[model samples]
Target: MLTETGKEYLRYVTEAFDILLLGQQNSRHAAAAPRLMLYTLPSLATKWLLPELHNWRACTPDVDLALHGTHAQFDFNTMHADFVICFGEERYAQLEKKFLFHDEVLPVPSPELIACYQGRKLLSKAPLIHLEWVNERRFLPNWRDWFQAKEIEEPEPQPSFIFNLTLLALHAAVAGAGVILGQRNLIANELASGTLVIVDELSLPHSKPNFLAWPQRTLSQPGSRQPIAWPVELAGTDS
Candidate 1:
């Protein structure tokens, strides 16, 4: 019932539509992979997270992680950050938070240093290493805090080294520089390898917990929460 020209036109129209759909499908498949931008302190990334990244890779093989390290405050919108791992109480009322883990602050010294101070109180005998966080607003337990918790009069020992980052202080302690008020969670690997030892079993629970936070709107997306959950799981395994 149809003329040859009409049949040919119908066939061309169908082919054009099929080609458009195929193009769209190819565009989606060829699109750049999804990336999640995560920000945190340099020490935390290097000491606590870096060692565990292989596990993260096995879990999120398809998602690319962009890790940024800094102590400066960041705007989520301006930085295009998907999430931030922060220490202390929640600061952003608008952001959703997930508790990762709590760490205890304690004195850590190299085995060599401990041997040198055998039978003596290392806190009073050995050189003290200090770590002062750049962001003063978030309080991390220091030697003074530990002493106060133990009800011992705090000493005003002049530190041989003063560092503004945890990683630096940790490395110093490992090099037998001094006894550092180390966070257990951050030095688990070092302790396991007998690189550092806890001094006198003295430790104070950090008043705050480390947490992961992100914009509430991110939850509207399908896979947004996926990246957030793995960190929490990893922290649990570390515990």
Candidate 2:
């Protein structure tokens, strides 16, 4: 009972709808592919989880990852990163926080420097390498807090170097630049390998546990998968 024109119109509409559905499915699949951008503290990136990140690539072969390291105060609103890894005591109200692990700060120096300071009080005269978080108000970690926790007074001014990145400080310490307050989790390998030596058994309490945080509303997105399992697995394996 339908005219030829009506039949053609119906056929065309059905084909168009099928194409649209197919296109939508393809778009979703493309979006679901494991592409993640992670913003983290520089210390965590260069020192602690660099190797683990390589391993993550191995485990999730389909993933495309971009890592950014900066101060914890980075603007989350402008960041396109899928996730953030940072250390803090309090969770951001706008983000979903997952506790990764706790870190302890230890004093570290090169082997030669340790030998030079052997059998002497650590703070006797040697310069201490300082990693300064210039923007301390934003919850960036610092060496002052660690010293305070141990009830140690700040050393008198001496020849010193200040670095924004923890890795640079670690490298400088390893290169015999100065004594650094190294994170146990970050410096484990260097300590074990004798590249760096712990000057004392003293460790300072960390300001916060390492955590994975993502935008609260974006938690359900497919790209959010990497942050969840990666940190959990890393922490578990570390223990």
Candidate 3:
């Protein structure tokens, strides 16, 4: 219904509107506070980070943090995550990495179980509860490793129950299901509440250390790099 010139003019108008809409969308994003997405293991977020979120807020009040708890690796290109907390010294060719902490694991059992075993010399007979590492490739400390660290000669006891998550394993121990080689940092609440008590005086080092990694592109964004720096600054903090 239109001539060639009319068709050209119509196309120009359509392109202009498209460009305007895109600019508005971008402007909206720019006007909003800068938000950073952080991906880490499920248990770390709930057991370690959640309690200390108040400190994080106090430090970076302006920037928003989107904490995503996941066991699976995410693609930076697709996921748009600003940072990742890995279980080991994960070397990414394009990402900058820093060490957080290598926590220790100790045998923790419910107080009720301790009372049951009171005056007994060998606490090794108590049922062991195991936490299955989601990533089989990474070496995480287990009951066998703890026993070796403690120089125990007897055969490692089989786990009464195995849980896939640290929280579940901790809960199982709290419920008097069995003893678990709980990370010292993760079992703070249970220990404080007297629901769980450390079996031995010695603690075994965790096989792998936790690391914080971020893509190089993260540094390019203004006001984005500061929030992530807090982790390294507060490395030894339980929260």
lDDT of 2 by residue, 1-239 (tens): 77999999999999999999999998886766756788887778877678687788777776667788877565568857777786773545567777788777777889878767655455546778877666543343455665676687866677887887778889999998788888788898898899998877877656567777787655655556766788788787432
lDDT of all predictions, in order shown?
Answer: 0.80, 0.74, 0.78
Instruction: Evaluate model 2: give its TM-score.
Output: 0.73
Question: Residue 165 of candidate 3: its Cα lDDT?
Answer: 82
After TM-score superposition, the amount by which residue 107's alpha carbon in candidate 1 deviates from its true location, in angstroms, is 0.8
What lDDT score is found at residue 225 in candidate 1? 67
Which candidate's TM-score is highest?
Answer: 1
Q: C-alpha displacement of 130 in model 3, angstroms?
A: 1.0
Tens digit of per-residue lDDT, candidate 1, span 1-239: 77999999999999999999999987775454466778897878988888988987888776677899988776876667888888764575578888888888888899999988766467777899877766562467777777888888876565568898788889999999999988888899999999999866877777788888899766664457666878888787433
> In model 1, what lDDT does residue 92 have?
56
Candidate 2 ranges with C-alpha deviation above 4 Å: 1-32, 72-77, 89-91, 137-157, 237-239
Q: Give TM-scores for every candidate, taking all chains together and pairing residue i with residue i.
A: 0.80, 0.73, 0.79
Which 10-residue span in candidate 3 carries the lowest summed lDDT? Answer: 116-125
Sliding window of 10 residues with minimal summed lDDT for model 1: 26-35
What is the descending lDDT order?
Answer: 1, 3, 2
Candidate 1 vs 2: which has more lDDT: 1
Model 2: C-alpha RMSD to truth? Answer: 8.8
